[model samples]
Target: VKPTTPRGQLPLLKIDGKQYTQSLAMQRYAAKKAGFYPTDDIDALVCDECCDTLEEFLLKFPFAAKDEEEKKAKRAEFVKGPMTEISKFIEQKIQDAGGKGFVASGPSVADIMLMVNVKSVESGFMDYINTDFYTNYPGITAVTTAMKEHPKVKAYYDSLN
Candidate 1:
């Protein structure tokens, strides 16, 4: 199944018989279709900036190592360095946007990306990172909290249970 995708990735979106790869691109397309993308140019730029920054952060994760211990060490280093810096950058972006837990005036794809990143970190799926790591960043955590409480988001999670 993976080999059949354009990029051999899990998130392959097929629209009207056209195959599309790249998770972020698919997310943006979905956002636009669902009205979660900003119409205003500046707001849309902010959303793109936030999403790109989040993507960069994810890419910095230490996924390749010669051994388990080395992997853990590298992950710890990432958590202490790049992870902290990126989180701070995002926190400031949220603050600049009126501390609303969103890069734009309202919830956009950027906010959704932010929420997902926060959940991933806080889920303890990444070793050596405390589940409460995001707790220190109120602005970042606020986005996750708001997203989780959103009616549609809440209902979707409820249905999963």
Candidate 2:
């Protein structure tokens, strides 16, 4: 699959003998096909923006930090600084959309991305980060909780374990 992908990425999607690359593009396509993507133009815009913003944050992280110690320091600084502001914005977006809504309408590609990133922090994927990252933000916690308890998500994770 990686060899067939244009960029040698793991998430290339093949359908009807056609291949689609880019994880975000595939995620969006899946969300749409699963009927989770918002139908309203503004809602779709919000979902897209949230998803892009979250992806950008992950991309901007100092994953290439020179040493383990430096990586830990960089991750800590990032979570305390820009990540704080991003969290605030996410909290606001959730509230603006209604407290229970994830991203635009409900569980969306944006929500899935957010949930996975949150889990990464919690699961020690980032050495210096922990589940406490979202402790101060109820809205973010709620979203992750919803995603975790979601039937399909839960079933997939259960299968993994």
Candidate 3:
């Protein structure tokens, strides 16, 4: 096999001999299979809220800063304030969604997606995850812990080492 930068094409997923390109499509399929998507109307709304926040953060903070002082300043200014507030907003949504649990009746694509970035921060990729970022949110912490222990997720993370 020829090697190339990560900019090269990603491997394809073929199902029933049909290929899917877009990641969202694949994620939706996985969500359906995983049964994490909401079954009720209101819960579905809540799920979208969770997904939206997770997606927003990825776009906002693409990676940890290599500039340590700058990262700390950014964390203190933007992250602890706006970013922390966003997390609380998501938590509030989850709390508002009644006893549905985890913004949905069960774990969905949103869970896995949020888990990816949260785990990155929790696993030492960021300096602030442990320092009050998720301090008040037990649900988020539990979710991240579960994601960290997930068999497949653990394997994928392990393979990176």
Candidate 4:
């Protein structure tokens, strides 16, 4: 699978016999096609900003720590510092966008990205990180709740159970 991908990565998109790499690029394309990408310039910028910030936060995970204790300490430090900071930034962004449960006028790729991030952190898959870490950030919670409540999204999640 790795060899078949353009960048030897998992996220490879094939369309019309053309292969595409880069998860974000593929996400943006899919979002646009699905009408989940904002059409307005400013809204698009906000969506991009939110997605980029979320990706940045994900990239900060210390996956290369030399030992379990070191990894735990690094993760703990990250949760206490950068993670909190990024969460606050996302919370503020959501609030600044009128607290509409989205960073733009309607559902966008940013909302989806935010939902994914929230779910990931709360999934208990990461050691030394509390699943309730996002509870304090109402804005983040609101967006995730809103996304989950969407009829289509709700149905999809329900099907998984």
RMSD, model 2, all Cα superposed?
Answer: 1.9
lDDT of 4 by residue, 1-161 (tens): 99887778878899999999898999999999987888989899999998999999989876668999998999999999889999999999989988765555798888888888888778877767899999998888988998878776788789999
lDDT agreement with native, every candidate = 0.84, 0.81, 0.66, 0.86
Question: By descending lDDT, how would the candidates be arranged?
Answer: 4, 1, 2, 3
What lDDT does model 4 reach? 0.86
**Model 3 bad stretches (over 4 Å):** 1-12, 62-66, 98-100, 128-132, 146-161
Write one digit per residue (lDDT tens) for candidate 3, span 51-95.
Answer: 777778766763567787777776666675667777887666656
TM-score for all predictions?
0.89, 0.89, 0.69, 0.89
Tens digits of per-residue lDDT for model 1, 13-102: 888999998878888899999777898888899889889999998899987889989988999899889999989999998999977755
Note each model's CA RMSD in angstroms: 1.9, 1.9, 4.5, 1.8
lDDT of 3: 0.66
Q: How accurate is candidate 1 locally (lDDT)?
A: 0.84
Off by over 4 Å in 4: 1-10, 159-161
lDDT of 2: 0.81
Per-residue lDDT of candidate 2, residues 50-85 (tens digit): 898888778767787889888889988888777887
Order of the predicted models by TM-score, top scorer first: 4, 1, 2, 3
Worst 10 residues of 3 by lDDT: 1-10
